[model samples]
Target: MKSRFVTGTLVFMLVFGMTLAASAEVTLRHWDWHQPRMNIKLKYMAEYEALNPNVTFDTQVIGWDDYWTRLMSGVAGGDVPDIAQFHNSQTQAFLNHLEAFPADVFDYDRYKEEIINFEAAYLFDGTFHFYPVGIMSGLIFYNADYWEAAGLTEADIPKTWDDFVEIAKLLTKYDSAGDIQVAGFVPNGILGVFWLDLHYQLGGTLYGEGAKTVAWNNPAGIQALELIESMIFEDRVSEVGFLGFNEAMGTGHAGMAYSWSWLGGELDNNYPDLNWGVFRLPTFDGKLAPGPVARNNHETGMSVMRSVRQENKDAAFEFLRWLYEDTDYLIEVNLVLGTAPSNRTLLDDPRIAASPLISAIAEQVPYTNIPGEIPHEVENDYGLGMLQDLLFFGYPAADALATAEAEANSVLMERAVKWYVEDLYTPVTD
Candidate 1:
């Protein structure tokens, strides 16, 4: 059953004149980061069904931990669904599984400004792979009570790493037995995004255009690592990996934690008693490091399976346009799933415009930078997690970055070599 049959009535709303059959049924299997939350995914599916009356959306959600694995397997086995959400990082692997089309994919030029001013991570030689959803950027969340206890007001938030160190020091408190009661900061989790952004702020580039090599050994990289090290070692202002990032942020164990805006709702909902607010990460020498952009900052997007028949392919993409470009559908995503719509035109939708959490994220759109556009996949792999765990175990900053860089480059080089051997690409080493 093709989805067109199930969604026949909705065709009336489309500018096109084709009407689907009443019994035309297509099951759209869409994959995303989390198993769709009860109220959220169901609400959208119900709305889509009501509008179309002919299509059925069968959503197969994988958790963040299992998403990549499930997606990669499906792709490799050619068992991918009608559509699935993909991260900007996962675009390469999934692109090989997507159907190609003529240039005009929803008038890309018309939404040029909405392209999110960073290097398009999903582009492989200018062939756009995924339809971006929403924006995600780094934010520094502070426990206001802790800052006030340290005799600092919201006005005292630092603008530089140096100033932040001072504030962190002031906020750190210890019990008589020498156990740290409250840490000035927590430095893991999404703070990893801060790693690349801060490297640029510290004056380093991961890759140079002419040379397809990793350049993390530069001075800026050293400085960035040193800054994180200073907070844990010299200043004793942070509890690196003593607890999970969420736990630290929620329980008031940390004064500040670098996280995404989406966490604001989680904090407000779960920790109802915690007094906190969000701010952009501090800058260096008065210049702010641009925040990293994600495919969707809050909620993700779906892509069609390359193996689906051409007609089904068209149907999948048509549904995608309706799901993403349609204002009503986009608003439903925001309202039901806590997603900030990526459709530039939806910025005015009262549903999204009214959310202060989503709006705060919207405010940072001008500062978003997509992470490295290199084709190799990045594995969170507990490197930051392990490094933070070992911070208290006395690992030096240089040693930590050196070890992590070596491992990271090893993984990346392996992939690069594989792609080269397969004639998919080549490295430009100088």
Candidate 2:
């Protein structure tokens, strides 16, 4: 077997062919919302600059909530950074403003096999836009101590929705005034994504008529909504009108939560004393589904903007090529974020495979799914907003889902017109 360094060197040569001599100095502006990984980015940038002394990076770290607004503003003004973070959700919204990865410079065909879920994660309109670094999948994190307290063990972990609800009920605790002291579960923490997962597990579809219409108003959707309602209301295992449920879980006030892989890192860093275990989301039945149980892919990637100069774009691509080929860098950055590395080769690294929590996250990578290319804001406005109503205001699941479906259909219609009609009407200047 080849050593790790030898393997990395071989991969590096296969990715970026014959290094060219640096001529003119170029400063590429790089932007990302992963503020937590700022130091890692800087470290990599320094190393990259050392490799090509003429190429430098101007890195900017923005907050997640404000990143979109800033990105949109930059896009409108034709001033986006040379390289920036690209979310799977925002791909449809900024498709026109982004630059497709040049096939000549980046050997996508060769590299695709090295990355996990490459086809599902980043391909759009027969073009690739981003270099995916890691993926964040939904996971059920339970406090092992709380599980033991409830007289449960690894063997007692839930295999079906019903079993999970039962386990949640047993783990719940109440205060003197009949208020919950410890929540058994927290479905509201990942409401929209969880709902989509449940919908798919129950054999539901989100799109209809060739993605031009919404089809989530069917029986499967209704059942998914009703289940969430029951969890928050009838079962009372999960508290209604509660936020920070994940934090509560970390503090031992909540027994279980349906959260993304990042929670594993958070627990490791913030609640080191808390014993936690992770499991894949239980299915509707007691069996694990053969494929993905969800529609949302929380994978994030880096992309070059169309507005950047060709020289700068080339520089940016060089850095990206090195970043993706460097297995150590990819693994380290992913470990910091508590996510599974998009580079499939690093998935089974000794460090990741040794840790049960990280290993559990890596296991779900193959079964993860990406959402349809819909406008990102539509889900937040129609899907998540309506679900919140059912949870906090006691709206009937049927009524809430119907209203949400109607609103979502309208949004889809608008998107259809923009893509099929309005875009055609606008003349292509280039």
lDDT of 1 at 104: 65
Residue-level lDDT of model 2, residues 75-110, one tens digit each, is 888878999888766766787878888888777786
lDDT for each residue of candidate 1 in 132-220, tens digit (9 for 90 to 100): 56666666788888877778876786877788888877877788986677777776554445566677556455444332344555677
- Residue 107, candidate 2: Cα error in Å is 2.1
Name the TM-score of candidate 1. Answer: 0.78
Best by lDDT: 2
Which ten-residue region of model 2 has the weakest summed lDDT?
421-430
Give the C-alpha lDDT of model 1: 0.61
Pairs of residues at least 3 apart in sequence or in different chains that clash in candidate 2 = none
